[model samples]
Target: MRKLYVWDPLVRAFHWALVAGLILNMFVTNPGKTAHRWLGYGVLTLIALRLVWGLIGPKFARFRSFPPDPAAALDHAREIVTGRVHPHEGHSPLGALMVYNLLASCLIIGLTGWMLTTLTWFGVEWVEDLHKAFVTWVQLCAVLHIAAVIFESRRLRVNLPKSMVTGYKTLP
Candidate 1:
């Protein structure tokens, strides 16, 4: 086995921060409270920072490291079907799609949530419903993300979640 530094500090921080913020908003913070709004804003800020980091951050942190390629994702799926192991130092192709999905979902949720606070959108049923719908979408994506991480970690013989926490992946 070899150890490789994968996730950078900022990337790790963003991952855990997003996890915490989502948990807080989903359970602890009431949507009607000022604290909830601030927390949501904080999450939006984190997402913005992450987007910038994906452009200029370290090698593995950059989006260039894992461009969204449908063919590559299909190949990864084939590898899984054939019981072949090909571990990526950064994100696997399917994982990249999930990252993009979560980012877009969060942005929509944040924007809709902010719209709810505006005079024009305040108490607008559809806008509020859109916000709630995205929240649910995020929640579903989070579950799928976790499941995929676990599956990949086992299939690749790497502690994927640990890599996020410690910025290192022990690969065989």
Candidate 2:
């Protein structure tokens, strides 16, 4: 067993903060419109920060390390199907997909949420519906992501939950 500092401080901070904001935004955005608006703004800010961090962050956080490689990702997917999961220093193929999806979906979700609060869109049914719809999509994706994390963590004997908190993963 070897120790690997995969997730850095900034990355960990961004991860937890974003999760909190997303959950809080979901609740606040519905009942308390004003709190919802602020939460949405916070989400937008977090997304922007993550974009920059992905570019300039540490080894595992950088985009260059996990840029979508369809072929390799597919191979990893195949391996997973065959019950040979591997914990490659950073996010595995499907995990990478979830990462990308989370960022993109959150961006769209946050943007739509913000749009609904604008002057011209006030009390607009369609905009609100679209925003709500995106939230549902995000919610579903989040659930799947968590399940995948738990599965992978168990299979690999990795402390993924703790790693995210401590910015360290003891590689197997």
Candidate 3:
């Protein structure tokens, strides 16, 4: 096994912080409460920082390293079906798509959540509905992301979760 530095410190910190904020907002903090609102703002800030980091960060942290490519994702799906293990230094194609999905979902959730606090959008049924819908979507995507990470880690012999925590990948 060869160990390679993959995720940067900012990337790792963002990942865990986002996880905590999402969990606290979704399951712990009551909606529209101060804690929930602050957590939502924290998530939004993390996303904004990640966006800027994607532009100026290291190789594996850059958007260019894992651009959302549907075609490549499809091919990756085919590879999975065929049981071919092609380990990626960064995110796999399907993982890239999931990353984009989660990012957009979190952004929408944050925006709608913030909108709910404003005088204009407060008590607006549609905005509230959209916010709730995105929260559900993010929850589902988070599950899928976790399952895929575990599956890929087993199939590819890479400790993906550990890599995210340690900023290194032990790849075979």
Scored against the true structure, residue 43 in model 2 reaches a CA lDDT of 78
What lDDT tens digits, residue by residue, belong to model 1 across residues 8-101? 9999999999999999998999996898999999999999999999999999999999999999999999999999998988999999999999
Alpha carbon deviation, residue 98, candidate 3 (Å): 0.4
In model 1, where is the ten-residue run with the lowest total lDDT?
Answer: 109-118
Q: What is the lDDT of residue 139 in candidate 1?
A: 96
Which lDDT tens digits does candidate 2 get at residues 1-172? 8888888888888889999988877764564377877877887898899899888888799888888788878998787789885778887877888888889988987777777667888678887788778789989998998898898888888988888888778877
Return the TM-score for candidate 1, rounded to 2 decimals.
0.98
Question: What does candidate 3's lDDT look like per residue over 1-172, in tens digits?
Answer: 7899999999999999999999999889999899999989999999999999999999999999999999999999998999998899898999999989999999999999999999999999999999999989999889999999999999998989999999999888
Clashing pairs in 3: none
For model 2, the superposed segments whose C-alpha errors exceed 4 Å read 28-32
Cα lDDT listed for each candidate? 0.93, 0.83, 0.94
Instruction: Compute the lDDT for candidate 1.
Output: 0.93
Off by over 4 Å in 1: none
TM-score of each: 0.98, 0.92, 0.98
